[model samples]
Target: MTRHHSPTARLAARMGSGLALGALALGLASQATAAEDYRPQPDQTPIQSSKNESFFGKTMDYIENNSYGRLGVLRFQYYGSSSNLHVDNATGLAAQAFGPGGSDLPHTGSSAGNTTTLGAMIGLYLPKTNHHLAMEVQLAPPLKLDFQVSGDAVDQSLAPTALNGANGGSIPTGVPPLGKNLGTFKALPPNFTIVYRPWTHTLVQPYVGVGAMYLYTYDKDVNNKVLNAYGEPSLYLSKPVACVGQLGSDFNLPNNMFLNLDVKYVGCADVKSRVSNIKVNSPTLSPTFGPVDVGSVSSTNHFRAVLYQISFGMHF
Candidate 1:
């Protein structure tokens, strides 16, 4: 009366139900995968260019530059003047007025130097900014620092007759024509400049700049004839710090090479210098003629000058 089903029938029915459920889950998973893979007919219009592609194209079209290295020649003209006579210590014949001792008495003198030498510069081109802007360091080595001095009249004793104040426009009274070569010295003048190239798109590029420069002298062995007439001679000069203004241009050549022309005006400093070590032998100039004063022999050199330079260079 209970209508009991067989155990085999029950087992087959359960297995069939399990198979249908598994097939349904697999079908759902397949549909989800197809949905993910299907892209709805991507917008019919074309996509806008990306920043990267635009940048790449511009790089090829515009004037693109990288690190710049150059070799140049500098033609320099230094114009300046000197100031008074002074010495340290004591015992040498005073320069005319003071007792056998150094004096600060200002004397007048003018000097100038000129040379043409090799120079070089290396720098990196700033990125993502004005293509024309670059920071550069320039190195110029002067093979010859040829200095010459001339001033007011002097007696046979070589004393400046016209003192700095008494002379005309720094010219002294009875000042003799004292023109002599003070010998050549080596110098290293380094400049730090911000170069501005106005037109880089063209084959020829023009640039202007301002810089801070330093003039340093080395191995300056001077045999001053005037100083030697009195005794032994030696010389010293102040390395000056200056401001420079420059103008230049670069012409492009084959194979990523360039020819450059540059001009600069360097304004130098005004300072006092010393000339030392001499035996004062003239009795007329000093009573203590035979004795030499190591400390008392020196000269004051007040100098302010502008250095003009013309340069040529090659760059890659």
Candidate 2:
């Protein structure tokens, strides 16, 4: 409708059209242009993994940084062991009195038997590795190593002395063979072992070790047969040295405590002991078997045993 209209009305209409076009242009510009992704400084590194919060790890870190210490804790162990006697080189007719008599215990002559005992252990860990140096001692009632023997001397009625110029003596009593408590086998000091672990953080901890042992014999009471024939009856044993090998695993517990199950195989040399004096009841044997004599009374015994050690320990 081309109707006559005022100049003011025309001006108003043009202004309204211009304002609407301006608004549309502004909205399109906003849609077309946007800021690029923000960039960080080269020194900054982005997180790649989740955070960890282990109580044990945090405690270890705190102790390592704040304190200076290397001393380790003391561990106590209760154990049971079974041992055997392997006689290697037994010489001298004199040894018949001590060895052939058989043993007092059922397993005596065939093998010495078992022991149940307590032990104390101390150790220090190497700087950063899993290696440690430790020493231990076993305290149990002495294990008797009893062997069998004829309990009496040759009958005095068979008076060989009468043949000689000497007066005949009364016959010695005749009694059956009996087992005598010769000595006690014990594992003593200078016990040293090296222990090592493969990993620090593990569900189950595994370890290995090797070491040596020094053994001692006590209460070496001679058999009754020897006491009747000889003036003095005593025994001697050479200290045995053994090589040890061990394998074990530890179970983790709370509060820095652990329980371990361990097994050890000890390889030992023959137990060769020299019975120093066997002065014979006969005058001629007196000269033959003197203190300074060899091949008189000496024996050899080999030994190997397994020890199961279960230990309860804690770290400081």
Candidate 3:
């Protein structure tokens, strides 16, 4: 027991003891450093508490880009013009004796206006921080139309005149009267619009537009028919110049095409007419009943609600 340990065993034991002491010293030093770093400093008086303490001075990150939007469109619309009147026959006005019979189908008031139009629309996007509202402007040219009014009817009173020794009754009877061929007119209105987009930059955009319609119309050609109380055939003219309000949606496609459907409300302004008097010479008259001079009969209409338009256009 008194003999000293071998050198190898002593060296191994010394190495283990040195390693343990080094680890213990390193742990103590780290503990001291952490405690010193985390130790609370003297309580200093705090500055006045502000409302935006947590988020104040934070960088408001935003995308940096020029804000601008544009749109070009070409659309086609189908529309018709209409008129209304009451049968004011208080003066015993018969179709044959007084005036021409009702043009049978109410004349459908000539939808034959311009149908095809090249509408060019351009809009701008106002700078908005909340990406919600979008403002735009649009201009569209006139819509052209081609319309005609024609019909046939057999007069019931024509048979009696021929039986009474009259070769061709006082007036041509039974045979349909010559159909009036009213030529076409450029019934177009210049359109200007202001549009607003609620949510933009998406696939489908819903918008509302308000605009003015300046309708352009030429004189309508009226055929010579049996004179009315006014002494000549009568004609009606559709109103020119209207204001419109539209609500619709645009389905934007990837290939620069849009499907637009809108409900349009047109305001009735006024209609101008040019009705001339005609003098008809009678075959059996002792004294020539001179041609009666017919004066102009014109009228302006009240508010009217027209048709709806669904169309397609190209976007550039």
Best by lDDT: 1
Tens digit of lDDT per residue, candidate 3, span 1-316?
0123455864585477457634543332232221212211113221332345332211110111111223334343434333522222212112333344332223222233334334443332223223343233333443443333322211222111111225645442232232333333444443545566676566787888776665555434443343332243445555567777867777766554566655556675654432334233322331333332323322234333443444464432
lDDT of each: 0.51, 0.41, 0.39
Number of clashing pairs per prediction, in order: 13, 9, 9
Candidate 3 or 1, higher TM-score = 1
Best-matching candidate per TM-score: 1
Q: Indicate the residue-level lDDT of 4 in model 2.
A: 29
Per-residue lDDT for 127 in model 1?
Answer: 38
Better of 1 and 2 by TM-score: 1
Across 231-312, the per-residue lDDT of candidate 1 in tens digits comes to: 5455566777777787878777765567777777777566444555654333332342343233434443444434333343
Error of 2 at 219 (Å): 4.9
Taking the tens digit of each residue's C-alpha lDDT, what string does model 2 give over 1-316? 1122355864585467447534443332232122121111122232121136344333333223211112222231212222222222323432332333222222322223355454434343432232332222222333444422211212221112211224544322222332433333333333456667675457577878888765555445454443336444445666678777778776767755667676767666555554444433434344444421122344455656666667675543
**Candidate 2 RMSD to the real structure:** 33.7
Please give the lDDT score for candidate 3. 0.39
